[model samples]
Target: MSGANKVQKREADAEPVPGLFTLVLHTHLPWLAHHGRWPVGEEWLYQSWSACYLPLVRVLRTLAAENRRHLITLGVTPVVAAQLDDPYCLQGMQHWLANWQLRAVEAATMRTASGASPASEPKALRQFGSREHTEAERELAEFDALWRHGASPALRELLDGEVIELLGGPLAHPFQPLLNPRLREFALREGLADAAHRFAHSPTGIWAPECAYSPGMEAGYADAGVSHFMVDGPSLHGDTALGRPVGDSGVVAFGRDLQVSYRVWSPKSGYPGHAAYRDFHTYDHATGLKPARVTGRAVPSEEKAPYDPARADAAVDVHVADFVETVRQRLSAESARIGRPAHVVAAFDTELFGHWWYEGPVWLERVLRALPAAGVRVGTLSDAIADGFVGSPVELPPSSWGSGKDWQVWSGEQVADLVQLNSEVVDTALSTVDKALARGGSLDAPTPRDFVADQILRETLLTVSSDWPFMVSKDSAADYARYRAHLHAHATREISAALASGRDDHAQRLAEGWNRADGLFGALDARRLPGR
Candidate 1:
């Protein structure tokens, strides 16, 4: 057989037999508000809200409207959920949606005038009054009206309405495997509690931060009432089974199917990189914004023209149909092959929706609609587990979807200085906690030593996050990564100095400084854990 034919045959044959297909979307971003705003801060939050959140909610609502139980699982990290539920975020998202409507109108006006010559009396003016332009204006007007209402209430309504299964992860979306065990436990517990409080129900599953996994992490999840969580493909020894329990915790770990997941959003190559999609990196210098399709590899930014939503919307429909058909075929064939049902799980970062892939939300909605018509059932992780799909027992090797699927991206030599600082912070904080607890010191009360210890814990966790080094390695907002690392490192150093000197005044001042700079995690009390 020819190589192309063989490839086509393989693609046609790769279907899940006798199994369910699951889609898990991880929605998370670090605390960007109050930290950074313009070039890369609130804009990041608002762009994601416009592209991913609002659209996703719309899709779920549409499914609900049809009286169809379209089961899909979603992970909203504590930090991201906190920002989404905040009044500022709710207001900001409304304003952002309004601006999007204005931009769409502006695009429509520009397209209507495309035939006009600079010196002419405007032949395009007649085109602007045409039926198509009027319809475009009406669509934009409707779009603006839909999202003009507050996003928080809509989000809360989605959760309350059972449109999608909500999942939670550790506070700040830290890579848990590399975190200090005590701090990791605290973060996981607090994260679950925070989700329960905010959403009015405890999340039974977690999208482990970055899909990173380790052996003993299950105990923490089990203790925190998490019934199921997700890991990368390799973490489950290449098995695409659902609800595999780790240890005696009864917490099920679902491994992602690499083939299905990479089809939509891979690190090196994916559907989103297709030439038809909008180019994320290259933007027009004139407008200081992204306004072109990725025509081809050699197409330069200056040569690219303004984006046409009509053209992009058509592309989204094609991709969505392909995706839905792919899922349907895989599920049907897999069910027949396995004698029992089989599952194909596809997972991806939520930021890829609107923030990275401009028309992702459109694709998402179409896919949701297409799946039911194809006879494929969509389910959440908990639904799969509750149905009793126990996977084979296997020891998951250490893994992350970061560079090389190892710690190199986060703990690589490039960030050796920051890594060393993190190590020292963890060690010193552990030592201080151990010493204070051994001497009958009270964690509930505020003492000079206790305050310093708390500060050290907060700074240690902040500096130790894999996000800083990972961002630096990718060169996406490298300066912001460096600043965050330095800030946390400084806090670590000052606290260490105060502890070593046994000076109450200096310790208090250091704690105060750290608190003033960033104080979200200061409330964390790690002493409650056993043997602390």
Candidate 2:
């Protein structure tokens, strides 16, 4: 049978396969508007936008056009949603896209060719430029047409069409394990609300920031109307064939199938390391574009072979077949072991596609199509639950998808200072907001515009973001992480102090200035700040 006919037969089969598979992609980035550029700031946001978001959306739209549904589960944190829809970021992204096209032109014209080390590669650089220029034009046109308004419109299109399931999390991606309970609840409530405001649909699932879980968080998830969430496989003790209920709550916790997930990405190896794939680290200095492939493990970046699109495409085909066979065997084995149809889930960061792994999106699109053709069932987490891919209740312990599958990454000795800073600043801000509300005799009323309390809460939330601690622990842009944490902590302190001192005018000015930078989650109100 033809490929299309095979897919139709598989979809039409009333008796399902022995198991099911679901892919989850968690999308997140800290608030970067009004932050620095280049080394670390808006540049991170723009690069992800042009590379990952643009192409990933294209792939989804293509699949949707073919009437595909529940292709994947997409968890977009409210912090990222805010940046995608913000006016400043929207305008900045346009300039970034246009600049990329210009850079491509410069590369093709040899206006900025480097003179160091390589003399036999001018032709290769020009070819790379031509390819990039074409890609940039396509991305720019897509941006101007579908994404000009912000991410919401296009995202709503996918959500409304049932092309994907959207997952929502707290306003800022805070590590809920160490966060104050009240603040945690408040952030989650506002976050779901922000999602509803933007997408016109509130998500019933969340990515839960780092897959971090503390035991009673299930109750919190239940309270926020979250029906399910993701956790690492080790948290489920490796029995990851189905979703498990947490501590008597109706909410389900799905664990990533590390056996299958690590096939695509692991600490030491994955498909991205294949010799024919594009090299992510090696760049041509002349045009600031990567031009090499992973020629070999021992090969130096300068000596790596020039990337060939056809070679990488062939590699994608091979990797897709391998992944399909892996999932098939896994599902078959797990079903026999459990004496029932099994469920397998693999989750990763959305930015991994086309951002970190250059050919990731293509591989993803092919895999989604290939799985069903191979008689393997695929669906979202919600679909899996509805289809009864659930098991006995599990009393999950304190865990996160971090280095040690524990809280050490965010709360370890390496970040003890950040943990302490978060605790002290959160306490001070909460108390200050409480007193301010009490004095107003309007503790339950909506917060007024320019209220010092709003900005105080904003900065406080930003101060405790999970990104800072993760960056510090991993030493990836550690200085930028420290700078951001301290910056927000300082803002929270200054604003809270101004309000406490009855310097209303000064506090308002400070709040306004800060809002010009971090003013997201407009629906957030001081009255919603839960008191300890």
Candidate 3:
């Protein structure tokens, strides 16, 4: 055959590139609209917005501009989505961006006539600030253009344009394993409705809060119309080469392929630890910039090497090549072992990209582009299902992507009080709503909108968020986590107490007061809440 004919013959005989690769990014944050700012609360939201959301969206948009479809599955929790779309948060984000610009300008102009600091130090600070100022302006422009009206428009565009497959999760991202069954069902249904409200499309896949799953939760998934959900590899006994249909339900569970995933991020090593990457923890106090590279894991902040973008770009290229090879090899090996084309799923937190690792966005863009070029097929979870990446049905164990691959992170001794608090709060809130609805003389009677019941549910949901307990268990911002948990629990208790004691006026007032801070998910109807 001629050269062109030979190439065509080979293409016609190729066996679908061995397997498919799917990337799942779970994007979540607790509601922080009217929450406190500074070292803990809304600051977390704003920083992730600037560093992770804005840049990550830019990369995805760039890829979309190239006509890449089904790029990845992105899970935006209902709580985070509500905050992103809230007027309070939009205004707060604008102020945060403006303040960031001002800080950058200050650092850039801080050189004194006496030059108290070393000459090299001032030069580095000035350069860092100038670079940050330019990046900040770019972010501001992107935010105003695409995200000013909240993330809905931008996210909707991505969905409508088929740039990504969006995943929706339970309201407030409660740890489902421990929730009252009624509350769990209610939360998941309301959460899907919320996503549908914002994006005009209901998501069939969810990044289950912390990927926590319990036996028979697939029934809930089937009830909620969820087609697929993610779980950690251990949940499937590490047989993660294909999606397993849990029980008899149609809901499929895709386990993260740790062999391929840990190549980029794991406990001991990852690309982010490379010497050329920007250090995440070593902040320059004078300028508020992470001005150093990792250099050596043991190197102190003061002795770390200055961050060099060119070097970081070089590292990204190297890692991209490495990751592409890793995926290619894994897919080949797994396909051989499974005796068919296998699936490789790598899941991560979206914030880890730009917030935790500065060069992550660049590396992400490069690897995504490089994978397909290296003869590996890339797609979303939905695409995997469509392409026959599922296997025989397998029963999943109670599991989570936490310490010990179990529920201890949220239910362990460190958070035993929180577990009890959640239990009492959920039980009280449900009974109160149930009683109020029944007291209307007819259980099915049409009654006036129960704003008090709505607030109670809101507080109850907020109190049970997996974040609070996870934070306490991990000792990351434990004080703030405990404070939030207690605050929400108090609202749940006080509101339920007043309403249960025939103090209608007091309940309404308390509900209104809490509504200012915790009011979200306007679609949550107390009448729809099932009786315990």
Winner on lDDT (1 vs 3):
3
Which candidate, 1 or 2, has the higher lDDT?
2
Distance from true position, residue 470, model 3, in Å? Answer: 0.6
Task: Name the 10 consecutive residues with the lowest summed lDDT in model 1.
Answer: 115-124
Q: Per-residue alpha-carbon lDDT of model 1 for 174-215, expressed as tens digits?
A: 778777787788778877877777767788888888778777
Shift in Å, residue 476, candidate 3: 0.5
> lDDT (0-100) at residue 239 of candidate 1?
69
Candidate 3 clash total?
0
Instruction: Estimate the Cα RMSD of every predicted model relative to the unseen true structure.
Output: 7.4, 2.1, 3.6
Candidate 2 TM-score versus the reference: 0.96
Off by over 4 Å in 3: 1-16, 112-120, 441-445
> Which 10 consecutive positions of candidate 2 have the poorest summed lDDT?
111-120
Of the pair 2 and 3, which is ahead by TM-score?
2
TM-score, every prediction: 0.81, 0.96, 0.95
Which digits, one per residue and each the tens of the lDDT, describe model 3 over residues 275-390?
98988888766556666789889887777776778888998999999998888889999999999999999988999899988888888887777777667788999999998999
